[model samples]
Target chain A: MKYRNPHIPEGINVTKRHPLKELLILLGGALLLIVALSWVFAEFGGGLARLIPFEYEQALVPDALLSSDADSELDVYLTQLSERLQKHMAIPEEIAIKVHFSGDDVFNAFATLGGNVLLYRGLVEQLPHENALSMLLAHEIAHVVHRDPIVGVGRGVGIQIVLSTMLGNPDLNVLGNAGLYTQLYFNRDMERAADAAALGAVHGLYGHVGGAKALFEVIKAERDRMGDGELPAMFSSHPLDQQRLDAIEEMARDNAWAGSGAITPLPAAFADWLKTAALRTESGRNTGNTH
Target chain B: MIELGIFLALLTLGYGFGQYAERRHYRSIIEREKRLNALPAIAARFPPTEPQHHQALVIGSTVISVDYFKRFLAALRNLFGGRVTAYESLLDRARRESSLRMKQQAETLGAEMVFNVKYETASISKGRGNTIGSIEVLAYGTALIRPQAADTDR
Candidate 1:
C-alpha cells in the first residue's frame, strides 16, 4: 500500500495572518491623513483667524465671566504676590494680574494666558527657602516674559479646531488624553528659552541660579513623599530631567552664582504665619496627599 | 437633503459614542471630587489671606470617550502588541472640548480668578471587543465676588 501522509495532502501551508494587523494598518492610514489635514488647516486657518480681527475680538473672553472668589486666605496672599510680581517684573500698569491659588499639595506653580499665575500652597510651604521661592517665581515670570500663555493658548485652540473639523468633533479636551497633550508639550527649544530667561531673572533677584536646582530637588523630594501614581500630570507637563537640571546648574556655575551663599533668609515669621494661615485656607488638606 | 441627512446620522453616531465615553469620564471625576473634597487641608508655606467679596465663581469641564472598540480594533490591526493605530481624530476632539469647557465655565462664573484647578480621567467601559471606554473631564475653579470698584481699578 502506498504510504501517503494524510496530513501532507494539503497544498502549500500558508502562515495565518491576524486580522488585527490589517485593521491597524487601515486605522493608521486614516489617522495620518487626519493629522496631515489638521496641520495644513491650522497653519492657514490660524493666519486667517489673525486677519479676522472682528472674530478674534469677538473671541476675547472677559475676565469677569470665569472667576469666583473662595473665602480662602490664599486668594488674598495671591493678590499681594501678584502686585509684587507686577512691580518686580516691570509688568506695565495697564496689564492686569490674575492670581489664583490651587488646592494641591504638590509644591507646584505655573503661568497661564492673560497673566494668570497659579501657585500651589504646597509649593509655598515646601520651598521655605526664599531662594527657592525667588527661583520658582522668576521661572514663571520667564514664561510671562515670553508671553507663552497667550501664544500657547492661541496655538492650542487654533490647532484644536482644525483637528476637530477633521475628526468630526468640536472640542479638544486636553485634560482627557495625555498623549495628545504630550504632542503639544513645549519643545526643548521653548524650555531652553524659558530656562535662560528664568536664569536672568534669578540672577537679578537672588544673585544666584543654583536655587533653581534646589527647587527641582524639592519637587523630587515631594514626589518621593507622594509615592507613585499619586503625583499630578503637572510634574510630567514641564518635565525635569537631569539634563534640564544640569543646564540650570551650568548657567549658575558660568555666572559665578554657585557660591552666592543663602539668597536671603526664609523670613523670620514665615513658619508661624504658615501654621495659622494654612489651617484657614487649606483646600485639599483632608486627603493627606492632595496633589 | 438625503446626503445631508446621512452625514448628520454619522455625526450623531460619532457624537453618541463620544458622549457615552464622556459620561463615563465624568462619573469618575465626581468620584474623585468626593475624595478630594473629603481630604483635610494641608498648609502651604505662605498662605494667602481670605478675601472678602460677593461673587459667583464658575468652573466648566468637558469629558470625552474613545471607546474600547476602536482601540481594540486598532490594537488587533497591530498584532496585539499594544501598538494600536493612532486615533488623532478622537484625541483632537477631546482636547478641544475639554479646554473649551474650562474656558466657558470660567466665563460663566464671572470669575476674576479661577484657582486650584484639577483634571481627572477614567475608562468608562472595561474589557475589549465592542466594549468602549469613557473619559470624563472637569474644569472647576473658585469664582470670586469682586466689587464693581475692583473693575475700575484696572
Candidate 2:
C-alpha cells in the first residue's frame, strides 16, 4: 500500500509575485481619479451647497450662540451696524445677513453658514476707530455675499465622500486632518476674493481706503506681539499682512480714492460696553488660570 | 515641505526594513520546512496498522508581527476592497514556522509520525484603525512514538 500526502499538491506554486508594472498602473489610475474628482467638486460644489435651505444652514450653528438675550446692547449695536452696512451695498434681498456677538476673547471674527457673521469681543476691542471695525465687518459681509461658508462645507463633504468611496472608510483622525487641509486650501483663494470685494464695498461706503490699511496694521501688531513665525504665503488661508496693506493701497491709488480720511469714533454707549466686555473677559481669564 | 520630506523618509525606512525582514523570515521558513518534510504531520484518523507504539500529544505555537511596509500596503489595499496579498505572506510564514516547530518536537520524542494534526490561528495585536499588527498560529498533533529494537528485546 502507498501513502499519499494530502497537504502538498504536485506541481503547484505557493508563492505569489506581483509585477511592478501592475502596481504602477494602479497608482496612476488612483491619482487620475483623485484629480478628476477634485476638479469636479471645485467647479460645482458651491452651486449645490446654495440649494440647501437657509433654515437648515441656520440650524447648523450651535444653539448656545443663537440663544442670546433678545435685546442685549451688543445685539442692538450689531443689528444697527449690519443694517447700515447693507444699505450701502447692493445686497440681495433673499440673503439677509445676521450678526452674532460672542463674549469670547479670541482675536478673530468669521462668516459662517446661513449668512451669519460672528464678532469676537477681543477683535472688536482692538479696533482704533469705527471705520476700522467697518472695514473688518465689510470683509466678513463680502464672505457672506459670496456664500463662502456653505460652499466650503459642500466642498469638504464632497471630498470626504469621494475619498471614502475610493479607499473605503479611513480612520477619523486621517479624515479630520484631510478635511482641515482641504478647507485651508479653499479658504486661501476665497479669502483673496473676499478681500478684493470688501475693498470695493468699503470704498463705496467711506470714499477712502485708509480703514482697511489701519485694520491690517492692527493685525500685524497683534502678530508681532505673538512672535509668530513667517509662514509661507501659499500655506496661509489669509494673505500676509504686508501683502494685504499693499493691495489696499494699490487698489485705492488705481481707483483715485483718498487712502486717508477723517475716522469716526465709536458711539459713547458702544465704547462703554466694549470697555466692560474687556474687563469681564480679563476677570474670567484670571479666574480660570488661562494666563 | 519639511513635512513631505519626513513622510518620504519614513516610507523609505519602512520599505527597506520590511523587505529585509521578509526575506530573512522566508529563508528561515523554507529551510526548516525542507528539513521537516520527511516527518510531515497528517490529519489521518487512525494510526498505521503495523504500529505498536506509544502516542502522546505534541503542540507548537508561534507569533509573527507585520512589518511597516506590509501594513502600509494593506492600508492602500483596504481602499480598493480586494485581497490583501501583503498579509498572505505573513500568515504563510507563521503557519509554516509553527508546523516546523511541531515536527521538531515530535522528532525529539523519537516519533515515527504524527496523526490528527490540527492548526489554529488568531490575531494577536490589532493595529491603529482596523489594521492587523501581529498574528499567532498554533499547531498540534498526536505523535506516534515507535519502540526501539533494544527496548523491545528487553
Best by lDDT: 2
lDDT of 1 at B71: 46
Q: Write the per-residue lDDT of candidate 2 for residues B45-117, one digit (tens) a residue.
A: 7878775868889998999887655665666555566766767777777787888889899988877778899
Instruction: Give candidate 2 misplaced runs (Cα > 4 Å).
Output: A1-45, A53-84, A163-176, A228-236, A239-271, A279-291, B1-21, B34-57, B67-69, B113-120, B123-133, B141-144, B149-154
Q: Where's the lowest-lDDT run of ten residues in candidate 2 chain A?
A: A169-178
Classify candidate 2 by CAPRI docking class: acceptable
State model 1's lDDT.
0.51
Can you write out model 2's per-residue Cα lDDT over A1-291, one digit (the tens) per residue? 333344464113333655233345544555566656754665467569978876687678765554332236767777877777777776766777887765567799899887878778778878888788888888898888888899887887777666656655342123233434555677878887877777777777777766677788888888888897547775577878888888788878888988888777777787677666566556656786331
lDDT of 1 by residue, A1-291 (tens): 111112222112222333345444655665565455555544454455344333233246455533422234545644654455345564534355566554445466777655556676678778857667766776676676555655555555656665554443212121113223333454334566776666666666655555667777777777677775332434355545555677887777787775466556665766555555455445435554342
TM-score of chain A of 1: 0.64
Interface RMSD of 1: 21.9
What RMSD, rounded to one decimal, does every model reach?
Answer: 29.7, 5.5
lDDT of each: 0.51, 0.71
Best by TM-score: 2
